[model samples]
Target: MRTLLQAVLSAMLLALCITATTQANERYIVKFKEGKESAVKAALDAQGAKLALDLPKHNAAAFSLPAQALTGLSHNPNVEYVEQDAKRYLMSQTVPYGIPLVQADQVSDSVTANIKVCIIDSGYDLAHEDLSGNRVEGANDSGTGNWFTDENHHGTHVAGTIAALSNDVGVVGINPHGNLNLYIVKVFNADGWGYSSGLIAALDVCEAAGAKVINMSLGGSIKSRTEDAAFAAAETAGILSIAAAGNDGNSRYSYPASYRSVVSVAAVDENKQHADFSQYNSQVELSGPGVGVLSSVPMGTALVAATSVANHDYLAIAMEGAPTGIASGVLIDCGSGEQQCDAAGKVCLLQRGNISFADKVLACEQGGGVAAIIYNNTAGQLNGTLGTTVTAIPAVGVTADDGAAMLLDVGNDATVAIGPGNYAYFDGTSMATPHVAGVAALVWSHFPLCTNKQIRAALQQTAEDLDTAGRDNYTGFGLVQAKAAADYLALNGCTAGGGNNTCKGKHCR
Candidate 1:
């Protein structure tokens, strides 16, 4: 009898909780009959409903009202069907690094707000602090999973790189002030993987939602006719699609990116050279900062950067194979070993060359070293791959200058610490794609009347020519230049100098 009474009380409590949650707030976008917005507003006013936003172009108004008021709305002679306003959540965070590089700060937020960019990837984490209030209502093409919440951090991170809030606390986006709304189309699952069919569906939805640009950071090696057709249709509808060239670091084609309808973006390092992990091919359209690219990540897991040799701070990239911990010790120079060296319990400092990066780390492990710091023999910070996993210790790469400084430390202890950071660094064409996409939106927002073709041409014409002059496979048309694109649009209008073709000789049709 006691157990039965407790169960009954628990059931009642659950019911109350459910009712409270369901009744909290209800919002809807109500479309009124053509030219009857005033009548709709009057009707809403009679029911004491709150108007959230007025959409004269769509003949619609977003309202917060009770069930009784909603019923009253349907009875109005001028009323059209109402849609329940979808709930959108925040996802990820970002810090400013790529924005100044592209000179996107020259433009204001009000200008960018006119452009709506659709991010077709995993769901967004609506709870992310930096991404608060950046979402707009669009189709959730994730099929079974909820599209508003991002379980996988990839989409959220991409969103941050494109448009993280400009608040001084976190990273500023390319168009940080621009009201460029992000329409998330959850094409991937919780594990950061998706099918081409899902992506195709997302494109259809983005087309209907009036998205100006589509950023696809996910791709597969195989080609699908269904996906290609969908991309072509999106292009026909005047949506600029930008995608990652793939991370294979080869000349092979990666589908969707390889599709002619899309602008296939390749990745470049800080030095404006092709990243070692970035893919290359004739299909490449442009390049953006990919190596050591910093952006937002899921909450709790931080991407910390704190390393010093001989008390002088220097930038370091923590190796993916590195274990989770702080490492500190007297830096011991490990000369090119044709023989085994004594590096027991100390931080082994290895110079680049003499052997592969993996073998050097292996040697450190064999000698019972606590950590391994590999410095570049030439220049720049080393971003080396160990080829395989090592459980012995944490490893990282420092610049040649830091490496030389460590070598000079004959007595002092060289400290290396790895822990949580608000931001993280990632590499690949995936990172570069967002930079181009964000700049595209920034340029598009400035000239909202321009067709997608015009925007694409503006981006291409404005890119800083890299490598060989003109377009090339390695660096595409060169790195994407945001300010130059905007300037071109302002000076040339939509069409270029020749006839009605506003796209600098590129065919619009």
Candidate 2:
């Protein structure tokens, strides 16, 4: 998938820029902020330099004329960077706790039914039982076949976090039944980070592919003009883009995510504690869990030690001693939604939601068991169906009824062992991003007429205020309030008021 982003981006970069120029041609990039947009445009027009992408938020303009064309505009004052458009932002909040949803409304409103979303990162495992049905066809853009196969598990985890199907089988997505068209645009290599140019191409392909929303979970520190052009094109085309603030706990920002037009998000734990690793910036637009989040993993791989599920397992660990791997012990993996927990080895117990073969082994390993067993956590007769592979270690899955009986008969009651079910308790900023994405999909989906800007603003406006009275950096606009988005769209998006014409809430504002 990352390769595909590279291939397509290279083609786009070569696709002839608007005004056409070589470095020696001396075209000048002009930028402004707050109240200085029109003056620069008017003055630049008077100088005969063709107007390019008019980015209102940054007060920046792309000009294809020589520096001489900017004789007046340059000295007119208040302009920022006067170089090429730089793609210099990305996303990666630090908190690990997933927000605890006290009630399971599971977003009944189908705000995003037909809209397409492009996730440009690691590949997605669409074949997983929980995600298989909701998998968007033609979602893979990784020119490299390996892109569809999330080897690092980051892409699949990120993908599962964003649009895992909302069906009652496995994990519940924010927009449970939002009809979202998903695309996997891989911009990273197997290792997970990629050059800016690769991601730049992805923006073009994503825009061309008709994706209304784009989720960029990966990022870097350096800036690039190539990236800026891509972002401008997408915004000009009306695509709403969301990016993660870097994991570095500093006010300094990363590219693409830090870009004025992109939505910069931070991370908060389930306790609503700000992540130490999440960047603190006046520019951060909103926030969600970046800490230990429980999300889907690759089909055949074991989740790295940093997983939130692992953290949850660590929390209730009744380790007799720090014994190595459990060769013969009963282990249960807890989950409430329809998630795919694939564990191998012994006594693997499943949680709520859907069951995949991996769920059993995943639970067993986490729970330190040698063999494997899985059970349905749902209330009905959970026939205990999940995805699994035949292994040297014996493995079997059972219904919630059977597992509870077995646990009671064979195990002691000293530990805080969460019983059989598909839902596993996990946390992370990754988990929170999808909630926002799904809700965005729902709003954008229902109100097809709403511009990408309107959708973004609606999300910000409706976000349940978690911290401050209005908007604060910790919670940003607050918890992603879905109904607020829906109601606002129905009320505001329905009848077009001229426009909100509000400034990007930042230091100056």
Candidate 3:
């Protein structure tokens, strides 16, 4: 991930709060008075303040103080907390962009049955509907082995995306047959924000647990000796640590993601374009669908939103209407509890779990509906998620919040349009990062013998170039392709894109 001149400076200052002990670059955070928001901002601006944001209720200005003025600003009565701001980044979300599991199996010859990927996010509800027996040995909040629970559902979503059961159950994860080892650190609070020390403790657990892949979806705006050593150790341990590129559309990359050692995963939408919130540049190694991603939630919960489930296989003409002119739509989520939805017109809102998005859409069409809108019932506002094998109707999505708002707005004359169209739809890079993580696990599982570097390379190298044609700020190595990655991984004596044997362009093709 990339960083801006302003963010870098500010993060250094804020890093102090978290005990960031890195000499890479000094950062500081300067707090100001509650009512003097404007004055503090203006003062920082005149001094060429790089980046600054109003602290929620603190009336403090957590800004990146210039090196020379740190002493003076820290002493100012208007200032409150002058410390390093850790660079917080979201965890990478991943999923299969193209090609199903059966197809993927055909490309590689190996057993992913034993690889135990360690998801280090919130934690899983092990008892989730889509994921259960698929979970292997692990640690969790229970303080005992083989027992884990996700108070926040984030870890559950990440876990399901990585390795939900392959059985003909609710949803098949990217690596349905893969073994997963969950390591719970609970760095993020129930609200999803924790102290730097908590993060370090989590990393300690991940490292000690002997996990193959550690997924970190939580991070702060600051970096500490705590995080630096943890990530560097992971790299040395030869374990793959996938991280999220921050959600701030700005180039303000977070730690671990920007730490140079971690594999920074960016969010690519269904359109195969980099999400507006996904960070970019050299550090962003690969890409995957991150908006409205579908995966298991807490409890036996199966959520429809994590990343916008955009992948859909159009079924043959089987609708009773014989369909004409209008693009009849069927969705897995109507953004509400009731089957009927009015986001735009008559549509069915498919309930999460037990049923399929396609089956629900087809049934809705049979029941006489013009369109469908599927949605996640999570905290944030998402529009839709990937749904395959649905027929006779176009489908879109909405987050639980927006969906509820629209459903509650019924009878009112107010127009409703939910979306990933803006900031509200954004809930951090976690929303978009799952796709990248899922895809990585899928491609890696395919080529069991391929070095982790090679798998990571195939993902980035064989991807279809989009957004800017060649590599650019938005989409890193283009959209992640399972077939391309699997095929590349099958090659012998392969290396990631770097040295002489690197794969790229038609040569990679």
Candidate 4:
């Protein structure tokens, strides 16, 4: 009987130790009654509580204390309340790299103008967090669906580049000051393809809606005379039309970008170099940041992935078509993942090459792997695709250096998180067209008296020249500069010959 009694006492002591250890790490806020702040603080200090913060304004203090002590303090007459110290996130806005590249960030955001900019593509996601607060209005010409619903996600991405609200979340657009009005004309279907007749009809909608700037992030090799005439007429009616210069990586002309009246925008990387996929022809009139361009997509539609090892985060790109999920397990090195070995319930760290990314991930999944990480075999980061193959596990890619670092902690715990987000990165001249369109509206808003022709000329004249000296086929007048063009109009007036053309009073637009 005495031995059994001693065993029960030992178990009770162990349980108490475990509970105390867990409670000691918990943080909470203790609010005291009026005139009891000093006394309550003294009592808490006597009990060995770790005070983190003092809030005399709120008559509260933050501390880490034992759960038993917290319960006792809650019953004290001097204590008003006790609450868990929940985490709070900063609702800050991210300025995309292209904003400052074109000098749009240097321009003033206080100026307001109701200059309408029309987007013609696969409709818009009107409910996006970054795009909801703007003065957005729409019209549907493609018959696929509603103008406010984005089926292909292309139009929503384009719209964000033009006027995503200056909200404290997601990303900010070129004209985020809520001055420019957006008019979306859905011409492309969910398949991301449309006929020239539909584009022409969309142009009509833009004209009727009083859109001074039209952005078309789409094009084809074939040119139609009717399409040509429609854009020509739109330009004659004081509308500035902008279009992508194709992504064929050739000198081939793509209409309606090849049309005489349209401003053909070519894609450039963040380094200001022409993208290999960006079409280069005599019609290529301007350049804008397009490669790896990050912008708003349909809410909860974009895939965001991250990988962390040993509590340190590493840049990771989710493999295209990979499943969305989160998994944490012991990191295991599975070379090439051609023939996985013993990766059960672990994250397979594979090296790039030997097979397609899909096959590698499939091999890992077959071996009971929870996740896969494929590191680049070359110098740069590996942005891989899974093609038509599907896998049940999440997979991501990292740079060669990061991969090497991850390999060092092979037996350590690692985590891979893949989920839907509100923004994504896309590459094409399709991405570049909106930057120019947004800048056109931003510059025009300041110079409301400037004619469409004058605004067009000012953009070309003040552009930062690149490639071979003056105008070239690859990048024409080079990268479009927003502040430079705005300053040009401030000094040269609305016309090329110089005239005083400042906007007057509240009737700016």
lDDT score of model 4? Answer: 0.81
lDDT of 4 by residue, 317-392 (tens): 7787887777777899999988965888888999999899999999999998988999999765567788899899
What do the candidate models score in CA lDDT, each in turn?
Answer: 0.71, 0.53, 0.51, 0.81
- Residue ranges of candidate 2 with Cα displaced over 4 Å: 1-106, 109-111, 138-144, 166-169, 303-324, 327-428, 494-509
Best by TM-score: 4
lDDT of 1 by residue, 364-445 (tens): 8788766678888876656666656665566777778877777888445555544444445666687888999999998777
Residue 196 CA displacement from its true place in model 2, Å: 0.8
What stretches of model 1 exceed 4 Å from their correct place? 1-97, 136-151, 336-341, 353-362, 365-368, 384-392, 497-509
Residue 345, candidate 2: alpha-carbon lDDT = 27
Candidate 4 wrong stretches, greater than 4 Å? 1-89, 377-381, 497-509
Model 4's TM-score against the true structure:
0.79
Q: Candidate 2 lDDT, tens digit per residue, 75-167? A: 667666477553222222111124234111434545355688788777766666446666464333445444466655566666665655655
Q: What is candidate 3's local distance difference test score?
A: 0.51
Instruction: Score every model by TM-score.
Output: 0.73, 0.56, 0.53, 0.79
Q: What are the clash counts of all predictions, listed in order?
A: 15, 85, 70, 0
How much is the lDDT of residue 43 in candidate 3?
Answer: 70
What's the residue-level lDDT of 319 in candidate 2? 15
